[model samples]
Target: MKKFIGISILALLVGFFSANAQDTAKNVTTKVKESAVKVGDKTAELASKGKNAITDKVYKDKEGPNGETIYIDKHSKYYWIDKKGHKVPISKNKLISKQ
Candidate 1:
């Protein structure tokens, strides 16, 4: 009976420890994913800025529908860079002139 009690206690402790370890691992994974997303966003923003500066014209006195900076591509197409670094095309009439 004593040996059985000891084994039961050991099993409970092991189960608790394994559950705690899984929680810690999940937390770590979540944090790592968050960090990766942040890094990717920053990298995309920098790349967009660099590409725009080199390959497009920045409309210093204008903005987009969401108040984003405006860029005119080689084809005279107006656009704005979104958070994911994609160009959101806009009409020239929709541009907001900055004061």
Candidate 2:
């Protein structure tokens, strides 16, 4: 009877450890996926900025909100690059003139 009890206890401990390890592995996988998404977004933003710098015309005396540099694309649409490197459209009335 004592031997049987010892074997049951050992089986329970093994099962508990295996369950704990699975949870830890799932948490690690979630963290890695989040990190990969952030890196991809940053890379896309950099590529957008590089393309705009090469293809758009810059406005030397005009500024955008928060002092962002203005640009005119091939379509003659005025815009400014935001912190995330997205082009934010602006009207002539909203432009800040520099002295």
Candidate 3:
């Protein structure tokens, strides 16, 4: 029983060392995509030498049906884009201004 416990601890240490030595570069990448409006600047700058998503344009923050926050450009008509870039439409009747 003692031998089994020692062997288990040794195995755990070896596994931890091997995992630590594994290349982390491949595992690190930005999972976010940038649309016309960019929100992933900081991650991109860290990823590359030096870069960022900067814009002089302005956007408005809006809410989806389920209460997800979304950003909208000035030209965006009754629709807002979700994080996945999918459109979540808002009806005129359901809008606070319209109501």
lDDT of each: 0.91, 0.85, 0.46
Cα TM-score of candidate 3: 0.28
Model 1, residue 55: displacement in angstroms? 1.7
As for TM-score, the candidate ahead, 1 or 3, is: 1
Instruction: Give the Cα-based TM-score of candidate 2 against the true structure.
Output: 0.70
Against the true structure, candidate 1 reaches a TM-score of 0.89
Q: Which stretches of candidate 3 lie over 4 Å from their true place?
A: 1-16, 23-77
Q: Write the per-residue lDDT of candidate 2 for residues 2-71, one digit (tens) a residue.
A: 9999999999999999999999999999999988878877877787777887899888888886787888
In terms of lDDT, which candidate is stronger, 2 or 3? 2
Per-residue lDDT, model 2, residue 98, is 74
Per residue, candidate 3 scores C-alpha lDDT tens digits across 1-99 of: 999999999999999888876645334432233332365544443333211112112123434455543333355545544444454666644543211
Candidate 3, position 2, lDDT: 100
Backbone collisions counted per model? 0, 0, 0
User: For model 1, how does the per-residue alpha-carbon lDDT over 1-99 read when each residue is reduced to its tens digit?
Assistant: 999999999999999999999999999999999999989998898899789978999999998877899999989999988887888899999998887
Which is the leading candidate under lDDT? Answer: 1
Position 41, candidate 3: lDDT: 48
Name every residue pair that clashes in candidate 3.
none
